[model samples]
Target: MSGTWQCSPAELEVHLGFRESNPQSKHAEFLGPPFLTVCCLLPSFSRLDMDRFLMRNVTKGTTTVKRKKSLDNDDDVETAEDTETMQRSQKISKKNNFDDENEPQTERIETLCQTFSEILTTDLVWKKVIKSNLDLSHTILFSKGIANTVMELLEEEVVYFTGDLAKVQVFGRWHNIPRKQATYGDPGLTYKYSGKETPGRAWPPVVKAVRDLVNRVTGYHYNFVLINRYKDGQDKMGEHKDDERELHPDTPIASLSLGQTRDFYFRHQDTRPPKKLNIDKVQMPLHHGTLLLMNPPTNRYWYHALPPRATAKGVRVNLTFRKVVPAAASSSSNNKQ
Candidate 1:
């Protein structure tokens, strides 16, 4: 059985389970399970059919496992790619949000600064006049268009104080203030006068723009602006010195005027009442869009006022910008207590 064996077609049909069509032919066809046993025992017997069947099943199983492993590796690569893409997108979104918030504001500020520089260089009319301790510098700061825009903005957005804050206590007598007033500045800044205190409000855009322009032109930093709106010439301010304890020592006060023209008078401290010293009073007309910087020692030695004039019938808005020392303001409040 180990070597080749010759057999009749009839014997082959019984052992191999197939009937050969040609009985006289030498080739025989193996058909069923009987061939499996015969091929396992006899090495020379026809075993090609069994070998081919087992090889096909083994190849199919190996191919299936390889395909599954490849598919799993592809899934892992895709998941990592998706995670990396999501992280990159989040970072880009945050950067875009930051740019959206700040870029426009920064560009606007820079543009304003450039416009101010141009206007100051070409159109400014500077005049410096010094009288005794009064160091004054006058200039036409704003153009007609800019001045009108500012007035419109103020009318629309600015809110004046009401109730107790709308009145001032003078000489133990409480009276309604003649003019509408407001204060805008940094936090904790307060302006106290005539036995009343005016707390600072947050700076409005128009006010901040004007302040930045003033600072650029005068090379001085001002943190607070006292805004006074006179309805007519009859609404006036009495003689007073702006020598408050909360003010920064030696800093100049920038006064910007809009609308009607009004006469500003400065009298020496010694020239009033009992002293009656022989000193000439200074008078200047503050016109629309004008800027007046009162330098150091002016408030210390002079009393300034805007008297009533029936001829000046139009409304006037005055912004007096000053620097406030927060520590000094706190100390002043403590002293009162």
Candidate 2:
């Protein structure tokens, strides 16, 4: 009576209650002066009755929403109450919609990753199986394909080693030089050989890529590569181990070979006790475009060399990757050569 009836009583009377009541009973008697209620308390139903009907229908229908918007005065812009009501409605919607899928619905996040064998060092189709012969030296071969790529980059433009007189000279003449050697590494690292301080060269692209690949496979990083270019079989390395003071004591040395194949030998450092002599020498033919990873303790316990291969032909490039201890980093700061 206070305000005009908003809901269509004639339309909803049968749906609300009239159809179920006795036909003899008047319409007013069936519904008892129907006063509709929306969200909050109104005049018709008792407190508990209104709350029960509201609590039940609020979770099931659009009635709660239409009523909440009426309080907002039909404005298009939402008030805080409207926002809170919408949020609650959303939570109810989510809860009601949370049905168990016939098979548990799984969201698959597809991603792809490349392995060392898949991208770089090994046979493209086969798994990269690292072979370890622990007697004299622990060495693993990367691939010929990658090795060729590395060589192409290095051979393009090279800066040979110079200024180290002793490295190239034995006695009075400059005759002892077996092969040309160039040191490439972090800036400021100086290694003294041939009676002169040889500072390292800045890393080149091919060399840096090899370093990255080595780190990915072996889990070790190197800051330097002692590049030895053997022009032919005549160019050979002596029977000696890389036990330099500047190198990291525990890290392995990575020797990558390119071009021609050659024989590389490892012998027990004569200093080891007689009991270990049974494992005296290990000789292996190092093929072209292969990487020989000489892990730790090999330098600690064995002596290795590229003994002159008399019948060998073509140029063989060797890149021996090594690490200089962090402690020596400061020492080389003063001189780059």
**TM per candidate:** 0.65, 0.55
What is candidate 1's CA lDDT for residue 97? 37
TM-score for predicted model 1 compared with the true structure:
0.65
When summed lDDT is taken over every stretch of 10 residues in candidate 1, the lowest stretch is: 35-44
Candidate 2 global TM-score: 0.55
Model 1 lDDT, full chain set: 0.61
Which candidate gets the maximum lDDT versus the true structure?
A: 1
**lDDT tens digits by residue: candidate 2, 3-95:** 011233332222222232124522121111111223321111122222222221242222242223333343445446445554653453243
lDDT of 1 by residue, 197-306 (tens): 67889988778888888888788889998898989977777666788878887788899999887877677877765566787777777766778888888888877767
lDDT at 5, model 1: 19
Which residue runs of candidate 2 sit more than 4 Å off their true CA positions?
A: 1-143, 163-166, 169-176, 193-196, 271-279, 329-337
